[model samples]
Target chain A: MKPLHISAYTTVSALGRGNAAMLEALRAGKSGLQPLHFPPAELKTYVGFVEGLEHEPLPEELAAFECRNNRLARLALRQDDFEQQVAALRERHGASRVAVLIGTSTSGILNTELAFRRRNEAGELPVEFDFVHSHQLSSLVDFVRRLLQLQGPGFTVSTACSSSAKVFADAWRLMAAGLCDAAVVGGVDSLCLTTLYGFNSLELVSAEPCRPADSQRNGISIGEAAGFAILEREPVEGSRGQLLGFGESSDAYHMSTPHPDGLGAVEAMQAALARAGLASSDIDYINLHGTATPSNDRSEDRAITTVFGTNTPCSSTKGWTGHTLGAAGITEAIIAMQCIEHGLMPASLNTRQLDPDFGSTILLEQRETTVNRVLSNSFGFGGSNCSLIFGGRNDHPLP
Target chain B: MTTLYLDNLGVVAPGLSDWPGAAKVLRGEADHLAEPLKLTAPELLPATERRRSSDSTRLALRAAEQALSLEAAQRLQPAAVFSSAYGDPTITHKLCELLSGTPPMASPTLFHNSVHNAPAGYWSIATANPMTTTSIAAGDESFATGLLYAAAQVVAEQRPVLLISYDLPYPKPLSEKCEVSAPFASALLLSHQASAQSIAQLSLSLDKGPETIMDLPLESLRRGNPAARALPLLAILASASGECLLPYLAEQRLHITVTPCR
Candidate 1:
């Protein structure tokens, strides 16, 4: 696999905007989960909802892409000077040479949720409710492409949770095939009623902040976030991260539940390591897809233990950002880069006790260590699974 | 952007149920229908899975089953890529109706099936294949995008790849706004190695030309559905002659050219 450098990255999550905020929260071992106040209420659960979304508005020219999902995407792009940086990239790569691939689960479905309530007596959707520009899954890619003024190949990936992580693989394939010289790969999923009530109905939402790997861990703390990464054929000056490899698989077990033994999860991890040409021992730390649910954590732990022998330091950042669903992939991948840059392993916050039934090393306290390669797992519903390997390049780029 | 072989094809559309039927329609042996086509459940999927399958899921799985069940596609678990422009609008409408009520009550069944990858999962489950499956959408350009992705995978991995592109009409509330009025799904089994049964060889490259859609007599039916955008490519595959260029990236307006094997 040709190593595609993650030249730049940004994330707007429950903690705050950009990578700095995520680092701050990680260092402080802060938990972002809070009681839910948004609509589609009555689910007594905690969520990692971003603040001030109501106060921010989309750029006037791009207002046609308005929705919670796009707003969050814009907010994320605004952070870490991502938009300006991409503008520079556009100048270098040429707009037509750059591609935009975005991943999203519920792309502006909240708008439809609201519009459904405003239906006329004849039960017709509102004329102003532009479904294609807003609620459609393609809207995220369309909005991002418009805002960035890109002309290269573009598409949207919507395979539940692993959607964004899989984008890294696509960018690799496209660039490797010389389809695009650079790509803007990322994901955005804003808080919406569908997930709020849907996960609740499935009895998968936890009432309190989730505790991954805890013996009594019950369910997940649903979260919303947006993240992006710039993948260039060459490494940018001072770039600390490169997409070394990625693996994707389908559990093929059930639609909603995970494989009891994490078979697909293991296969994905092994494939990522193989693609990266790294041994299992080469992994410095792992960002588990530990959504804090009993089934998810247990299954992920088994997979981790099988691959890394329960000695590799690993933790679930969901306690800090909650499970951001589609956004989890890039969000955590950025976190893995942070680990390589700062030499910090964020602990699995909120888990007071480890699940005795598991054998994986589930870190509970922040550890300051020399980090190199990091593996991040993101498994989605309907059996979509993706594992991404980032960082581990020892030599510094020309500065 | 690598040359690959199209080992086989499967497509379902109005007045067309299989490649033979589609070839006939393209050759004027059969008349293209104007009415929406009804989808049939795939017998390969178990009763329980099929019962839970929506029209979109059934349409997707049936096409793949048709292609993979053929002798040419010996490996049932070829890496799969599923594409849809309008994903399960029926399920989305149903969920909307439930959520629109005073107190929202979501059906767990519909919620699971609403994800764009639901159909992809059912394919793997029915075939007992746990390999990587990707579900993507490119609005009206899904067919071209899916083709590029599948071809790239075949070249990169040096293995046969299964590509399924499907789209179905939504209920009234969504249909009144969305352009799709008919349901369509098509499948292609591609590989780097040209087999004895190869239908045609395709060399894909980005075309910086105008977006070219297929010219079908059932204009309204073809234009309304996104999957029908593949008709021009399908017509060429069935013709066994000539070259074709189809629309791709929306803003780039890039086209993908497909040439038949001599």
Candidate 2:
């Protein structure tokens, strides 16, 4: 496997401010979900809302790109010590060698939609309105690159839930193929009436996000988040973190539902293990893309059963932060990496009764464990599945 | 690296919908695209499933059906990769509207289809292949990204892979960014083994050149017509050897080297 290094990473979900805050929330079994009150609608539901975000004004530089989603991205990128780390990378590897890849379903479109609605009613857009601020999907990635003052291969992946998860694969390929030396990979999705009402229209949103593997599980609670990770070729002997392998599979099964047999999920997990040159038992913790949806949990449970059997400790962080859609992949990947950093596996929240079909291997409560290799699973709507393996530097002894 | 052959092809575009129909147009047997090929969802998809899928999903599934119609059942399990530029913008726009409102509510159908991999998901279920699938989006470079992703999966997994790329014009207002007409989907069943009439080899690289390839119309190229891109490769292969340079991105370019089998 090509050597890939995660030099720096940052995440801002309902889990909290930085990686430390996220780890603490996971350990405490605290959830970031809260009932959101905004425009009057027929249906109201819980959301993984980030507190104190509405008050944070954008910096003068990013003022033009302001929107709920980009605002969250600005705050996430503002993590303590994050800029300094990124700056060092920029200095070391010229801006052109640093690539930017963002996974977002709605890239400030909500802002544009608001502006459009006003314009439609009044027959004109406001004089101060800047359509470029919210129009193209690439704007988010472009904005981030300019803000960071780095240039390389700038790309925006908008593949629904798997968008950001796939960014890791792209970054790995770019670095391995010598396209770029370093890359910033992450996703940003803000909670908006569109997602809320859209999910409500589909009837997939649960009144409450139920237990992931529990028999009584209902559906998922949507959330907004901004999660980013910096990947580069690993340096000599000692390095911050390493990306072992990322395995991807396409089910071509259904638009909305996963295959009943979980074939794609199994293939992805197996492929990741093969890429990492490790057996299933080698994984200490599994950060499941447990969106809490009945079909998703069931299919994923079957896949887990086929791979780890009844041993690996697995939990869904969606209970802490509602499914962040595209951000879920990276958000959960960051959490898995945190677990590897600190030797603890976070428990799944709201889980009381486990599904009889699900094996006992699924961890229901937070527990302490010796961590090394962590497997993170992300399955998107189109049966597009990816399983990423993350481990410490020493996990793979030098060749 | 193993050489991948284009064993079968499928497309559901603005004018062409089925394999025979699309092939006819590609072969210059037909003069125009049909009306059924232009049919929109709510009409094309079943009610039960229609409520769950986005327009992209519908278009992709239709294209997948056309691509797989002639292939055997055993070939269905090949690893799959789906690519798109804009993804489900219609649902995305609706989701945005719901979010800006007082009480947020999301449409389950739209949310389900909003996933970038929804088309891949639908194709897998519709075909019941029980294989691995990957969904990718890379802005304007999606075609190249999709090819790279498919090639990687084939090399890593050592299995045949299905590469599908689709893009639809966002409904009203949002359509400004895109120039293509009607929703379009194209599928290529790529395998390590060569078939009856082999397609040309794909070689990608970074090169400096004039920004545009004036030799071919952008519309025909964007429509996935072989004449503009695929036919050139076929012509090169038929001549025993040939090469053509295609504009990749602004900073990079792709030079395709083609050689026909004896």
Candidate 3:
């Protein structure tokens, strides 16, 4: 397998607008979670909602595709130096050699939902409700491609929470196979009624923000975010970050639950370590996919313990950023990259006391450490799981 | 490069329930297009667990069972790649409906099935395979994506992979979203070696030409009956000569150069 370079990246989450804001928030231990209030209902809960985005106006051409989810995507794409990074990549590699691969569980279905509401009320969908713009599974990827004028292979992966994490694998394959020189891989999932209500119905949404790994940990707090990373086949000196390895596995267990023994999760973590050619002790910190759901946290804790034991520091960023669903993988991946770059590990916020059942080492506060290698996990519904290993440019020797 | 062979193939589409039945229909030996069966949770699922499955889950399980027989089903472990275009639209629509309502409440079952990988999960549970699996969705190109992923997995992991691609007709609100109609499912058991007597080697390449292939109808090719496209390649391969270009989308062409070695 060939290595894929992380040329440049940017993210838009509840923490704020770009990489700088996110890094600053992580450093200051600022929580992006806040109470959310929406029309047609009243539910009191904390959400990692991106502020000021609700009123962000879309351009006339992109207005027809307006929805909560796509709005977040547009806002993320319009962030500081984000468009420039994409343009620079396009210039380095021809547009056709650059691909767009985004992961989003809800794509533009939020818009479709609104259109359906209107249809049900008026007995027909409005003419302006373009199905192509509303429900195409590739809508977000297509939107990004059109925005950046990319002609390469555009795709969207929707494998639940691991959606964005698997994008790294896809980009790696494309680059290794010489299909594309560079690719944009990440995810975007915004807070919509469907996701909130759905998780609530599953009894997985926490009344308050979550406390991952805490004995009293209840459920997850949903969030919205859009994060993108530009990946290349080869690295340029002093340019950006690098992706080490990614491992994926499926547990044929129950739909909503993980394997009781955490076998699949353990296999995926080990596979990632093997691909990166690193040992268990080589990982300095782990960003766990701790949704704070009882089963998920315990299962993940077991998997982490099996691999890293209780020596390495690990924490679930979901405490601060909330569970971004499809976006959680990439959003947290970006956070891990930041940790590697800055030599600091963000604490798992809102978790006062660790759960006795969780036997793995966990970082409770923002700690200064010489971070070299970090592993991030994203486990989704249906046992779709992915683990990504990230290290600094000089952390490992060139292959 | 090592060549991968298609050892065995099975399909449960709108017109057939089994491979031989499908072949018969393709050969014009059968007239009636098999009535599309709506996979009910009760009929296609484990008797005790039927109430827990969604429509898409039922369809996926039924199609997988029809694709993998009792003998082959026993051989399957968790390592499979499931692909679909629109995954569980019924659940997706229900979620959307909840989002539109006051104090939204999404069904737990619906939420579980909404994941694109739900089919893979169901198949793994049914087959008791604990191996690694990947689920992919690539619009109309889902089948090709599955084939590519399966081939890559076989080459990378050195394991025989089961590739299942399925999609059910979208419900009313979602039907307005995409232009697909009628439910269909297709499965292929691919291996690095020729495991059976009827093995076909598929070589795909991008070629420049005016779209349409000689003597091949564009309509039938677009209808997703790959056998129509496969027949020409089979004829050419059987004779040990010639190549067939199959149209993929409008701008792209899948130049399939087939060779038979038995």
Q: Second chain TM-score per prediction?
A: 0.92, 0.75, 0.79
How do the residues B26-64 of candidate 1 rate in per-residue lDDT, one tens digit apiece?
877778765556676888777888778888889998888
lDDT of 3 by residue, A1-399 (tens): 445678777899989999999999989988888887755435667889888876986678876666677778878888768798888888889997786888888776666667767775545666678766646566677677777888765677888888899889877765654556889888999876667777777888888888898999899988889999889877764556678888888776778888777877998899888888788888889999988988898999898888888888998999778999989889988999999899898888889988987788777878997898889999888788899998776556235
- Candidate 3 chain B minimal-lDDT segment of 10 residues: B225-234
Candidate 1: clashing pairs of residues = none
Highest lDDT, which number? 1
Q: Judging by lDDT, tell me the better candidate of 2 and 3.
A: 3
Error of 2 at A147 (Å): 3.5
lDDT of 3 by residue, B1-262 (tens): 2346655566555555656676555445565354767566524345656777776667666656654664565564425777776777778767777666654567777777777777777766666666666676656656655565566566555567777767766667556556565566666666666655435776666555754332323244335432223334333443544566544332555566656656
Any runs in candidate 1 off by more than 4 Å, and if so which?
A393-399, B34-36, B70-76, B208-216, B251-262
DockQ of 1: 0.74
User: Which should have the higher TM-score, number 1 or number 3?
Assistant: 1
Rank the candidate models, highest TM-score first: 1, 3, 2
Best by TM-score: 1
Question: Model 3, stretches more than 4 Å misplaced?
Answer: A62-64, A120-122, A397-399, B1-3, B32-34, B40-46, B66-79, B193-198, B208-250
The stretch of ten residues in a row with the least summed lDDT in candidate 3 chain A is: A119-128
TM-score of each: 0.97, 0.82, 0.91
Per-residue alpha-carbon lDDT of candidate 1 for residues A21-74, written as tens digits (9 for 90 to 100): 999999999888899888756678889999999988898898888898999999
